[model samples]
Target chain A: MATDRPLTAKGLATRARIVAAAADLVFHRGAAQVALADVQAAADVSGSQLYHYFTDRDDLLRAVAVHRAAELVANQGPVDTLPALRAWVEANIALIAADNAAGGCRLGSLVPQLAETDPQTRATLSTAFHDWIAHLAAGLTTMTATGVLPPTADPHRLATLLVAALEGGILLAQAQRDITPMRTALEAALDHIASLATSP
Target chain B: MATDRPLTAKGLATRARIVAAAADLVFHRGAAQVALADVQAAADVSGSQLYHYFTDRDDLLRAVAVHRAAELVANQGPVDTLPALRAWVEANIALIAADNAAGGCRLGSLVPQLAETDPQTRATLSTAFHDWIAHLAAGLTTMTATGVLPPTADPHRLATLLVAALEGGILLAQAQRDITPMRTALEAALDHIASLATSP
Candidate 1:
């Protein structure tokens, strides 16, 4: 069991701030370029205070990865029908636009950077992906169960394709510095999915 | 126009060897983790010789990206019919498996790494992607012209989806260290494409 060190109300707020700032930097600046000092400055915490809250940089990175994974899952939300799928997709695009171009997917960025050198980091990345896949698959299963999709469907396959399409669409969107390709590609994918449903 | 340096036959061979070596390392080791010395040793070239071909590490990276772009195009080959498409995909999977998970992707790995910070590097990556998309699109157009696909079918859309699907499939395959997902995903996607022809 892990030891429990209760955080003060102020302490909890500061730590949250630190993690958010770290995520912004890691996503925009690339995890490797953002140092501990940078995270401290962004969080507006003193060096001693930052160290006190976290054991070290890796501990903080671990936290950031988990935070980003949850955010990624939360970003997708739920899906009911074609319109719901479209709305979910629109929200996702807005999430990217809100970050401008500085932040691509945080978990996506961190995985490639650490995949080669750090085993623990790789495991963190893998877990994040597994969580993400499960969230998507669950949403897909729900869509099928609710009769938004036909019973003769493979949620896992659809979930896999959806994730891949989004990631690939994001890649093109980032390259072109425009969301049209991303939007168009995703819309087409959703259309494909809609065709799978029995007409209401 | 860029200057074309005069080279002996042997010098040309040496340059190809170096680029191939770097390509292998970048593919298997991930680009950021590879060192100059490792490339030097693998290529069997002296330090001076390596520098002679590429002005710096970034230049060498540019070369590798170019080489990879060519390799990607070659791997996709000429897409004509169902058999051709299957062959092209299987060839790509075999190539990835040969590397034993060392190389995830060349341009895919470099895009996020270079785009945010370096404009010049970003330009190179953008060009590589543009070339790749054009190659796939051209092949798709031919397939449609041959009456294998519908006249109303948009080749560009299918091309875009093909690229997206491959990238996404590659990501999953890398994480799981299994080729099954890649194979299954591609087959399913191809099945969808065939469905387009039969749809009433």
Candidate 2:
């Protein structure tokens, strides 16, 4: 668990810096390879300050996971229609392409490493994904309510599938060092959702 | 590079045992967390024996990745038609459920960790995925040749999408600790392929 003590504004700023630094390192370098000293150097915080913010490396990792989830959610904003969902996916693909398809999805990259070994961390990630799916589902629900999608469309299920396909596409793209795989996979997913449209 | 020396029958057995044990450890414990001592203890091999087989942990990890790819390919057997493809996907879902959705795809789990950090290992995993994708594409190609799929269907693209969705679905299911996400994602992929049928 993270520290429960109250923090001043400066302390909060310092904590956020540490988490951002840790998130970058963990995303590029695997969690097992990152050390507290690395985080300290990256964040330019003293040893005592690092310990003050996080109880241990695991605690810091939890913070990084949360930070990443928040960043992803924030970047995605809201999705209230199929075009919004498609644009959200395109943004993800564009991000990967911008990075040369080198690193995959931040959450996707971390979950496989930590999900089985750390139950608490896994739960945090799972909740992040659940919330993410819920956000997408909410958009789909609106589309259905507005009569854009067929009444038979299950927003929850479709949203889950969209997220799943996106993660998988990112993985394949990273592995192949190309964006086409990701693009094709996501295109198929969006097409599937469009097929659920009432006019289709 | 691995050792260039030829191994006797007994030597081959020892090397295979070390890789198998390492694969098991890396599957349950993240690659970074599994130590040399853990590999030695799990394989019941002496320190020198471990070093003699693998120059370092990275080498061992590469071997494990290859071993995992072989195992996955062997498990999938063949995919020559839409039904065969569906069965292949069903088998993957069943394997995850059998493990209680504890550990996701071995390749999916490892690719994110090592793909960015190690180029050689990334290449190994990339080739494995490429080969796996080719196998699926072969099935789709056969379907097209047999008039089951329309000429408009690009086997390579569809195969890539299928793999991407499977990996993504497995990641979501593993994170959520449920099989529904994986099942749904795969069902969508298979359905997409089915929609490419000549009549459809």
Candidate 3:
């Protein structure tokens, strides 16, 4: 019943704009400090327009979480080849570095804030991560099938560590505000992952 | 001037109680939502006593961040043996899992919140992390020297990844509300770490 109506083209555009603004504001400020008015102001939309796009702030936040999740996955890049995985990881480090540690792992940040207080919001975050892990798992599976990884390398386990390590990199990077720890840590993780592929 | 005075015994006890209460509250409730009154209520201290212990709420938070940082490093346990490392990780996961993902990482949650807005606060969080990394590096370096790990292994790099992995694992484990990912990821990371050990 809740999923009944699909927004039209114009409506979808407005929704996207709101989500983008909300995410940027939350990243810079914080979810706690951001007001609904800030979202409308940043998006350059009227209050009525904001309400039209989403019923309330929570709805907008959920949409923002979805938007932010897409950006996280998108930043991983197209790791089509074994070498591409390294490139993807380096690009990820650069992307994180560019944010100056101010912009954290979007889905990771939002998940902690929303997970406990709101069940539906928690579910939304859980779904975002589930999709993220699935994408990674699929990538690892393809690499394994391509003989880029040894038969003993479990794609699921490798993918789990990949996600874990990347998130870990982000945590340290943010704390230090320097990319070295994040870069060094990730390179080591990639090296570990690559070591599994070398013999194959 | 700030570090000049030796605190009275009563002052020390009051400050300790306040810090402990603040840690518990902020760790459970989002830090931003936590108020002085909440800390006072939780600590069973009066408003004046709270202010006496901490000049302001930020002071209390900074102290809590430091205390939590100490706890974080302490959680790593004794690194006297390889089996101890394994046991430390196991206990850490159990501690995190027992919380049911309701309370996010205290230092991590506070660090990002401070990153863009407060330089002093950010530095405080950074200091905590620096201490954490240092302890880890010490253990890893010892492992290398004792021939538990290959001399070729960069203990610094490995230690850096280990910290990141633990934070990431906690984040994921909390989100999934399942211990499997955290345990699996940590074990895999440890396995990778152990693979570098020189066989006796």
lDDT of each: 0.70, 0.84, 0.75
lDDT of 1 by residue, B1-200 (tens): 01268777998898889989987787666666678999999998899998888888877877776777677666556776767777877876776677544445566766665566666666666666667667767876777788777787767777666666666566656665566556655665665667666333
lDDT of 3 by residue, B1-200 (tens): 12337888987887888899988887776676789999989999998877666778777777887788777766656763578778878777777778765575667766655555566667777877777777777888888888888879887887777777777777777677776777767777787887777874
lDDT (0-100) at residue A45 of candidate 1? 90
* Per-candidate interface DockQ score: 0.47, 0.75, 0.63
TM-score of each: 0.87, 0.95, 0.91
Candidate 1 residue pairs in backbone clash: B27-B103, B28-B102, B28-B103
Task: Order the candidate numbers by DockQ, best to worst.
Answer: 2, 3, 1
**How does candidate 2 fare on TM-score?**
0.95
Model 3 residue B14 CA deviation in Å: 1.9
Question: Judged by TM-score relative to the true structure, which candidate is superior, 2 or 3?
Answer: 2
lDDT by residue for model 3 (A61-91), tens: 7777778767766665555457787887877
Judging by TM-score against the true structure, name the best candidate: 2
Error of 2 at A94 (Å): 1.4
Clash total of candidate 1: 3
- For residue A161, model 1's alpha carbon misses the true position, in angstroms, by 0.3
Q: Given candidate 1, what's the lDDT at residue A126?
A: 69
Candidate 1 residue lDDT tens string, A1-200: 01258888988888889999998888787766789999988999998888877788777887787777777766666664667767878887786667553445566666555566566666766676666667767877888888878888777777666666666666666665666556655665665677687875
